[model samples]
Target: MTSDAGPILVTGTAGFIGFHTAVKLLDRGLEVIGVDNVNDYYDPNLKEARLARLGERQGHQFHRIDIADGAALNAVFTQSRPRRVIHLAAQAGVRYSLVNPHAYVQANLVGFANILECCRHHGVEHLVYASTSSVYGANTNMPFSVRQNADHPLTLYAASKRANELMAHSYSHLFGLPTTGLRFFTVYGPWGRPDMMMYIFTKAILDGREIELFNHGEMLRDFTYVDDIVEGVVRSCDVVATPDPQWRSDVPTPGTSKAPYRLYNIGNNKAEPLMRVVELLEQRLGRKAKTIMKPMQMGDVPATCADVDDLTRQTGFQPATPLEVGVARFVDWYRSYHQVA
Candidate 1:
């Protein structure tokens, strides 16, 4: 039953994007080997529910393994022998990194090293991993482009993800590994994390609680829907990156490389104001939100937008989910999931 794609390994299968990507892969008649530690970063119940959904699929076999545990991770690679890898596991949360710096080191750094080694030893065809928009750091430019520098990372979380990109590039350069890194914008949808603004604001409005507005509702985010993100992930796996003969050190670009490494931003391409998102949620839920405006917290940028021209040109796809439609769907799922009125 092995197709040309082969069995793909997806880390963090219990997480939002990982689970959605795994399901999409399974639907395409490909085998998936899923791994997740299932820690209590947010709510374990939601993670469990996501896992359960994946369990319903036939071509999936899940392992409760942390990527930071190199021995356990290597065992999975030896056993599954996945032909391609979509590495999504990491300690997530930008603000939380302020208090928990070590978590990023263990998960993002150590886990990433383990993944690269596994892919290297296992002879994987293509490796795709998740990068974040936060890597843009202090760049105030509209529609953050991969061609721009991302050396300034405000938080440990962003720094760790940036390091992952560097590490992948090194592996690609040294070992001839075909790798693609996706810088995902603010991804939100049904089964979203409780810590994300979309879920937090929706819950606060439904409960008549005050939701914190950072930067006094002036901040902007290109909130890419989960399904759109999943599409990007799958397409990236299909389009294996190749060495760019046009790459030259005389005039360099961050998007392509001399080696088989590529980076693309996966985002909505629309920078919607934070306040607009809140208003849309209010309209969808038929409830008013009690607001508490506050200045921007540490390790956070003012806005982020993705320049997806390269992504469309390469994969013939770009995230096009409308904000209102996506928000309405999220509200519906939130109401049904939480049994809200």
Candidate 2:
């Protein structure tokens, strides 16, 4: 982004990653105008808690708006006239998409359209949006790389995010909008979404309830820490994407195009077995969790490990936190937040 660009506009500020990224930016004393509807996709109280944290920070301005409503979103752009946008707001969840497909359509698809147009017409310097590792669906390749084909998505959620990349590419091609899309692996830490594995497993273990161990302990994930993810995000925002001069349509790489568009994976670069995550939690909380063995559900992958070579190569950054340490920090926060002994 240009040095003279206006205050950063970040959507989904009430959400997990959004909240963390916003706080980090604010801590740096950067002007940020956050947008979120605060819809109850999960527990509204959790969303409220995240927002409360952001509220405590200076240079953090907020708007209660939904990106799905084009008029409201457009109004925000007209008012804030932000030059750099971190478009993180979207219907996020793999299994939930199967149940409520329309939410994905409205938030992920339609909402992204509004953001693209805003960036195009508003003379936005750069647009960085969230993509997902789930886009690497059905590809059995260990340590998924950005250079690989991701045409087959097991869930609508992943499909929508992949579409966001395509849509952003078109805008970059047409309007010269520098766009960077980061495909994040299983992100976790304090202030994580309750629906994700980290929070669910931790909560169940504490409650003495049976945690659903999907794929019968065979699943693998590159569970990234939230702080590390935020570091990558902040760096990506500062460095606007530029067109790859070497990119050739004759044998094009999907990760980059002739336009100012780029894709990189932000992950731990380490895939841990699902059982290992449980084991670490058991050690942290000092409690045994009864496991309900279950087959892999639809829209789910057997394993995911991100090859962050390009992420490091292009951005000069990496996720350095170890899973055991991150999980321990989370357990500490969880116990404090919920007042668990």
Candidate 3:
């Protein structure tokens, strides 16, 4: 079925990646049912603004509901009967997890359980959920691949995300619910989270404030742009996960399964050094950022790169955004939207 004909349910519509994905789906003539709790994670106003933009579109329907509420989630599922579900809502952030661990359990665990239940009951064609590269926790693999082992998660946040992958796999095996888990790497762009690196770095630089250079600017990140991530997401939604005939229990691939479940990484194939990103920002904004070099914090990895070849081969999805071009566009958007100099 094409996007234009049926409705697709997208969770966390107010969030960065969710907002971009919903916008792209709606633009493709899809009827989008968007949901978000509008929690004060960063700024609820930004979330509200994102909702406003979605509301302006003709085929979009929004509900300010918490996914953790099972009854509420079921009610919406019964009413909408969405053909596909994109589960993006979660208690997001690595640093914040250190302070508010309960938030991660409630939103990421409980909310995700609710979404899986709804999808299972509704007989959704595909259930595409967000997993994080943070799940690669403590793995120093040069380019993180779905085929690699990811058992040693560092933070509670990573653990929770890893839990999501397992949860999806369970549902896929038991209920035959097609599930695809996306391990996203350092997504950033316009209308991005104010707490994210790009927004924080750009804001601090513009305001003549010092930007914290974690790991002494020696970190490397895939830094996938929001648009590229959204494209990969939409294409994945179109291709339902299938059980691998070659998947033997004796030797299993971490990416695929004998059940109707799969995992893929959406990231820039090219990794950019942390310092290089700062340099780009400096050049784009014509402002010199006061830098503060610091050792790596706990629950933080020094680098993350994604091997997205599986995604390309399976769904014909490839992230094509160049770092310089994407960064420049983000800078332009930040200035225009925030009225920054």
Q: Against the unseen true structure, what C-alpha lDDT does each candidate score?
A: 0.92, 0.92, 0.92
Any idea how many clashes model 2 has? 0
Measured over all alpha carbons after superposition, the RMSD of each candidate to the real structure, in angstroms, is 1.2, 1.2, 0.9
Report the CA-based lDDT of candidate 2 relative to the real structure.
Answer: 0.92
- Which lDDT tens digits does candidate 1 get at residues 122-177? 99999999999999999988789999999999999999999999999999999999
lDDT per residue (tens digit) for residues 1-341 in model 3: 47555799999999888999999998898999998889999988888888899999998998889999999888888998899999999999999999999999999999999999999888898999999999989889869999999999999999999999999999999999999999999999999999899999999999889999988889989999889999999999999999999998999898999999999999998788998889999999998889999999999988889999999999998888899989999999999988876
Angstrom error at residue 12, model 2: 0.3
Instruction: Rank the models by lDDT, top first.
Output: 1, 3, 2
lDDT of 2 by residue, 17-100 (tens): 999999888877788999999998999998988889888887788999999999898898999989799988999999999999
Candidates' TM-scores?
A: 0.98, 0.98, 0.98
Alpha carbon lDDT of residue 27, candidate 3?
84
Model 2 alpha-carbon miss at residue 154, Å: 0.6
Q: Which residues of candidate 1, in runs, are more than 4 Å off?
A: none
